[model samples]
Target: MDELEFRRQLYTNPRNRSEALLQEARRNNKNKKLYDDMQQLENKLEQALNVEVPDGLAERLMLRQSFDDSRQQYRRKSRWQIAIAASIAFALGLSTSLFHWQQQAADMGQLALQHVYEEMPYTSGVDEQPSLQTINAKLARYGASFEQLPGKVVYVNHCAYAGSPALHMVMKGKMGSNINVFVVPKSTELKTVQSFSDKTLHGMVEPLANASLVVVGEMKEPIEKTLHTLTAELNQAI
Candidate 1:
């Protein structure tokens, strides 16, 4: 199976022991790592959800019944305590891991690269050829619009950016290359990055008055021209 299909299947059931998935995971180290992470998260959630009654609660209640003025009240309070404890355990376990993951993606450049990788399976192909008007409509909510697109738009959607909504677009580039452009609202805490790259992709960030524009493409593909074109075409819609 392809990367996208494998990811979908694995997400459907992280503990899947299908031969196809195991083979794919064996073939690709990245896939194996992702599978492991998903499994860990699944285990944590299961452990959190598996709330068990404290030992000797029945005996303790029986003991208290002899002298307790209001047995009913005491039982209710015990139930509430147990419920609260379970909720706290679940929240602590979940939030800790999620916060750590978010911190790892705190860098604007790293976040952009990570987003590109996640969406590449879908965005690499020409799934949709949206009009400039359609693209601008999506951008309008982000306080920006395009007068003329830099290139042919193949895919466009709104995706998460640091827990906020951001515009994601895939445009056709020179020599059959695909370029990813992200428009994120300006944030006080997250400063814009000049540029960033990995083994497979490289990109630059352009900070605007109302938003930061990130342009990403393959390692060797020339993205500076596309960046300039987009910078010129972008008009403040607010």
Candidate 2:
């Protein structure tokens, strides 16, 4: 048969005479290659025909593919949702921690203020006679000189320091400066002196009149200078 008629018969009646014709073509040199190619194509066609398609297999495959796509989309959306939830939880935790810290800070500030107020002296009756000379003499013993600043001394009292009463005084100074002086009784335990700076003001603690004296002021000169001058002058007069 001609090539076109052979190919037509091969496809039209692939079972009958096609196998016998292919075996004869394989024996010929030029038809050998064609026979092999046609055998391969025929085998592929047999495989395609023998493949038993399940009922609604195409529809089931399409449904499975759609399900896989939906599953992938859900997974991606779930990841985003989890990430968003974690972010919200983290934000809430941070806010809660910050709020707690602020509350603690406020409570600490109040406690500090309360402590300061507790240590402060209270004023009562005005009937008690004011003994300015006797007060000055006691302060002088503690290396503190009693100098009348421009304003009257509204507050004068003795505070306990290391079992001894230390003379404490508050007086108004020039340019709205409030002068505070404390004379501690002399003790070996109060030898070490320290100074601290708070904002613009500098304060010092040192041995004066046998006790630890802490003076706070904004004066340009060193605190030691003021302490030394006051102590020397007071000691000499006493």
Candidate 3:
């Protein structure tokens, strides 16, 4: 047989013509080498393709052809079943991962808000009436160097900022406006300004030399003026 017919016989049905050809070649001494070379080439091709020429596979194919029945129905059914099962498993895994991510995000948000509320100065009892001298003295240690702006210093205490001890003072401004100042020594004053507002009060921040000053009050204009004057005084002291 020609090369194409020989290959087709080996792939389509190896049991029938392949063995018969080998037996015929062995009977004919002239074709014995050709038959041995063909067998070796076929073995090499099978190894390269990683396909085992099962003895039963060719028998089953011939039997099915003779019976005229569909032989690949079971394989097609198995493939479809495996595909559907894989899709369902992937969807379930994806949903579980998304749910876990969302839960972690919500927990992180609550933790962040709680930490921020704890660090805020307005939430503490620092506004209660305290000794003014003690407060000013503590502020002086943090480089406040105050000249006592015309007001009754009613509240004085040290507050924590970013794990460092800072000064917090509440002095009665003109017209019953309370001036709350926060001083941090290690932080350098920058030109940036920011505002914060709670339900009951509003506050502004300003930079001072080697420190940051924040004043929380109800009126904006008076607080701004006080912050500007305090910033100038604190800068001169440094």
Highest-scoring model, TM-score:
1
Flag the better candidate by TM-score, 1 or 3.
1
Off by over 4 Å in 2: 1-131, 140-152, 199-201, 218-229, 236-238
Which pairs, if any, clash in model 1? none
The TM-score, computed over Cα atoms with residue i paired to residue i, of candidate 1 is 0.62
lDDT of 2 by residue, 158-208 (tens): 654433456655444344444455655655433344665544455566654
Tell me which of candidates 1 and 3 scores higher on lDDT. Answer: 1
Top candidate, metric lDDT: 1
Q: Which ten residues in a row have the lowest lDDT in candidate 2?
A: 107-116
Displacement of residue 94 (Cα, Å) in model 3 is 22
What lDDT, from 0 to 1, does candidate 2 have? 0.50
For each candidate in the order shown, give its overall lDDT on alpha carbons: 0.82, 0.50, 0.54
Clashing pairs in 2: 142-209, 184-211, 185-210, 185-211, 186-210
Q: Model 1, poorest ten-residue lDDT window?
A: 58-67
TM-score of candidate 2 on Cα atoms, chains taken together: 0.35
Expressed as tens digits, the lDDT of each residue in 1-238 for candidate 1 is 8766688678667999999999999887999899999989999998977868785555543334445557688768768766666567669988999888867667899888888887777666655888899999999988888878768888887777776788989987775789999998988656467999999999999988789999999977789989989989889754
